[model samples]
Target: MTYALHQGDALRVLASLPDASVDAVITDPPYNSGGRTAKERTSKTARAKYTSADAQHELADFPGENKDQHAYGYWLSLLLSEAYRVTREGGALLVFTDWRQSATTGDALQAGGWLWRGILPWHKPQARPQKGRFTQNCEFIYWGSKGAIDGDRNPVYLPGLYSASQPSGKSRVHITQKPVGVMRELTKICIPGGTILDFCAGSGSTGVAALLEGRNFVGIEATAHYAAIAEQRLRETQDGLAREAETRTT
Candidate 1:
């Protein structure tokens, strides 16, 4: 189990990697909500109702969040293209996006030469309800393969919808950090013992899951602060796994 975390722009870092270097790409990039829309959606009242005071201020401030639709689409396409280049043939790419950008993300995935598989819905059972509106309780995971996928035929198959509660405030290192269980589930579907790449690693939840599952991980975070946090979290994850193995051996 190996892991490396780099502090740099995801696009630049991804471009530097060699072709077919990674076995899988699993990441949660910015939703590119144009800042204003995201701010409007998170009204003060809603924040107070949903998150604690400390958690409210810790919301992520990452690059590309304020991009207009056109720019966001272009940026997403470029990133996906790099992902496709680095991923081994038949490797999978799983990216998380919100409803507003799901269509664009899917289109970008196809544009990047990835074989469009399908959307995986992540159901957050504890999602907050809005008055006079349907609850926004799910996020979409865009799954695609770099080329033809080769895998064993499973008599029983997993469903497209994955039900898991969102990460609690206490466990969140990044504002949009995905639940560890969600990352683990996605990782399990990839080739065993293969390397996982996350260019927009945020707080490194994906790396933690990969290491815990005995897979190699390469993560790139744009901000030094978040990169440091991710490194610490990954170190802790490795330590925990080592302890578990030692205990089991004894």
Candidate 2:
């Protein structure tokens, strides 16, 4: 029902938050992937890696995509460790990653003191087809818990596979914005009214979804451009909720 968005380094902001403060951490950090070779993956900017050459949108690029595989693993482990400290016991972690970084993400989750649970595939229907190979149309979400998950607390049966398309045209604010429909479903993992933290909250998709789902949100964005965009989206979501509440009350 409420949200707090911090514009700064995610690690630094997370450190300032109290331990056992949040109920879940659902984040989609940069994959640091796009090419098979190290040079291609490390050298290219986020816009160059994720966006096509002829893409119509003039969306701003994001950071944290330059790290090589080894560096990425270490950085992710540190972030997850910080997130684990912020989460209460039995709280959950759901992180978005591509096939190239799935193994590393799982390793980092365990390294961060979380119990590895399972992987959820997010199928993108609009993905372009490839020839002579399996079409890489799916992204993965690695989910786990701080400890043993007490299902009795928040007993909502979530699906294993999520299918959604990326936002396009005017609705797309971030280069890698997840669909609000998908995000709303993902937000249900947390208990009703519980707080969710998204460290890499580009354009506030996760925070907006969390608030609309009757949950509290705490977000951290590093880039000022995306932070301002995120703040605007979060405010609009809150205003819509407030209007809805007022309508029912009156």
Candidate 3:
């Protein structure tokens, strides 16, 4: 397994990638659903918006969480357009977003020239309940394919929904880190040994999962702090894989 982590603006970095270079684009970009008003969006930090008052961890806030709803749509479309160019025909894209931004994300996916497929929900089992309304426990994955999808190429039945909780305790490095187990299963969207791109790599859970699943990875992170953390995590994953291989051969 191999992986590359680039630290820069995702939109700019994506433009530099070669066309048809990756088999899948699996990313958890910032949902930007924190604040409704422009003033709130600009003023509130990511940690202030997303975290509860008594939240234990002190993870640093990431950028791009301040985009207003209208700006978010345009920004996402441009980023997705570059992503589409780098994905081969029949390749898939999976973007993570909350209910507030799901519809706009779908529109952006199509605007990027991808053939919209369907939604895949990720249900958090431990989500807090609201007495007056339904629990806001589910985040959605809007998936699409570059042109027509050829199931024959990566023939495998995958689940329609995923059940996983956010990373916790010492394992939680990023403010919005996804579970590695969920990412490992999601990486199956790509063919074995094929490369996957995650422009908003964060703490690199996506790349770590790809390497663990026998796939290659190309990750881009905007925050230097998270990029360094991602680099360390990727290196640790590679070292762990090498140890396992050596143990088997020994």
Error of 3 at 16 (Å): 1.3
Better of 1 and 3 by lDDT: 3
lDDT of 3 by residue, 1-250 (tens): 9999999999889988999999999999988887767788767888888888888988998988878888899999999999999999899999999998988999999999999999999999999999999998999999999988888889989999999999888999998899999999999999999999999999999999999999999999999999999999999999999999999999
Q: Which portions of model 2 miss their true places by more than 4 Å?
A: none
- Lowest summed lDDT across 10 adjacent residues in model 3 is found at 34-43
- The lDDT per prediction is 0.82, 0.95, 0.94
Q: Name the weakest run of 10 consecutive residues (lDDT summed) in model 2.
A: 127-136
lDDT of 2 at 42: 98
**Between 1 and 2, whose TM-score is larger?**
2
Query: How many residue pairs clash in each candidate at the backbone level?
Result: 0, 0, 0
- Candidate 1 clashing pairs? none
Whichever of 1 and 3 has more TM-score, that candidate is 3
lDDT of 1 by residue, 1-250 (tens): 8898989998889988999999999999877652236454333332233344555455545554656667778888999999999998888899998888888998899988899999999999987799999998899999999878777621225578888886765686666778888798788766778899998998899999999887899999998878998999999999998899999999
> Listing every candidate in turn, what is its Cα RMSD in Å to the true structure after a full C-alpha superposition?
3.5, 0.7, 1.1
Q: Model 1 reaches what TM-score against the true structure?
A: 0.89
